[model samples]
Target: MSQGKQLPEFENEDDLAAWIESHDTSEYMDQMIEATDEIEVLRTRFSTKPLDVRLRTEYLEAIEELAERRGLPYQALVQRWLLERLTQEAPDLMTK
Candidate 1:
């Protein structure tokens, strides 16, 4: 690492990620340090299976428009709606 060049402070992960995306890490290799303390890692796994459903063109277009407005994919919006309805109809099934 160059003595004159120092790592810039980032306000958040997005800013750090942006900086890292544009810059070369090899330049800062000397400054990088490995963690010496013990660390615990916890991971959660979710199992999902794909389901295909057919819908009319008009309904699909409407769903896509609504999903775009809500900043979510149309498929995700549909999944959410299905989950909501299922929860309403069978709350006990959702607990499992």
Candidate 2:
């Protein structure tokens, strides 16, 4: 067994993710403080980064049309569709 170190304050999920990628969960899981009382969170937000990709203009226009019908921004529609596809084809990608 390895000695566990104190977990640091994470600024965001991305920061915590970077730490997890380099550290073994077993090494730190045991060091966590036990919950003595109920904890409540007021809000939840996901951190996102800008991703630029080139696509065929026709496909982009079609996406825009579909998004418009759904009253959503094209980018949001694309993200939703991509997430749905990833869930089916590559769930591991979602976790990472």
Candidate 3:
């Protein structure tokens, strides 16, 4: 973002919303500049098989606590941990 960048002054949220309704997002795309180390987009998709497991209450609580602090679902945190371990140890395990 550049300093002193001026945006059109709208009367209120309704005005802004009305303006947006008439505008194409691409019209302002040029105003969007990528900052250093910023990502343009993030997307993920893959076929997955569901895995269900019961965890002891204490373990579940610990996972939930850490996941909350990291802003991730507990299952995602678990999956990432498993993936990291597999990638570090036997990378072949991740394929099948």
Candidate 4:
């Protein structure tokens, strides 16, 4: 590998991502390290399971229209509404 310039230290993943997005990674090829170490991957807190709920066509259409106006998927809007209601009703249950 060529003696390329050293990589800059980033405070967080966002900074590293921004740097990589703006710069040519080819220059940092020599500074990169192989991922041989075994790392534990933790499950995400927002992991979701498939839910099957039957809703009336009119309600579904209204939800789809609202979600479209808000630039979000209908299911995501529904999830957000549900979470919001849950938080309002029982804030303790919503705690991580």
Candidate 5:
């Protein structure tokens, strides 16, 4: 690769991963590790917002039951359901 040359934009996560691997020398690998760690920290920091939700026992039970039926943890199911609802209700929130 030439100095000052720019790589093309990766279209998806898989493409990005492949590009990173292809570019991996010892120095570039270290940079990739640091970049991945920083990305994880960014994801955690952004997802750290507090939510004070109040759900009735019946609703909670329903969620648990649905989660059990889907073989997913209750919290995972609840989070996915809430995400779906928010996405449907306010589609532009994700774009922002």
Candidate 6:
């Protein structure tokens, strides 16, 4: 639902193959594989169910304030935080 975060839609291998072929260049295969690997990492990291955390009123307010200041929804802020943490902890698990 975010402004620029549309989920990907790949109907089938033919569609994907067409896309790959259309974008093909000498380095495109390597880049495409790297991007696919990165997407797999993202799926593995973020597919886990969220854990419930109890927060004090003031702490919750602070988080909300920070999210508002960054112009991001609370969930997006949390996702970015987790992604950053994961990338820092496992540098090889991320891609450019």
Best by TM-score: 1
lDDT of 1 by residue, 1-96 (tens): 568467888899899899999998776767767669988999878898999889999999999999999999999999999999999999989957
**Per-model CA lDDT versus the true structure:** 0.89, 0.86, 0.81, 0.92, 0.72, 0.70
lDDT of 5: 0.72
Score candidate 3 by lDDT: 0.81
| TM-score (all chains, Cα) for each model | 0.53, 0.51, 0.51, 0.52, 0.44, 0.41
Query: Residue by residue across 2-90, what tens digits does model 6's lDDT show?
Result: 34433345799898777666753444333334434433344345345777888898987888899999999977787798789989999
Residue 21 deviation, candidate 1, in Å?
40
lDDT at 26 for candidate 3?
58
Candidate 3: the clashing residue pairs are none
Can you write out model 4's per-residue Cα lDDT over 1-96, one digit (the tens) per residue? 677688899999999999999999988888888879998999777666999999999999999999999999999999999999999999998867
Candidate 4 TM-score, C-alpha based: 0.52
Tell me how far the alpha carbon of residue 27 in candidate 6 is from the true structure, in angstroms, after superposition. Answer: 28
Task: Extract clashing residue pairs from model 4.
Answer: none
Q: lDDT: which is higher, 2 or 3?
A: 2
Candidate 6 achieves a global lDDT of 0.70
TM-score, cand. 2 vs. native: 0.51
* Candidate 4: residue 39 lDDT (0-100): 89
Q: Between candidates 2 and 6, name the one with more favorable lDDT.
A: 2
Better of 5 and 6 by TM-score: 5
lDDT of 2: 0.86
Winning model by lDDT: 4
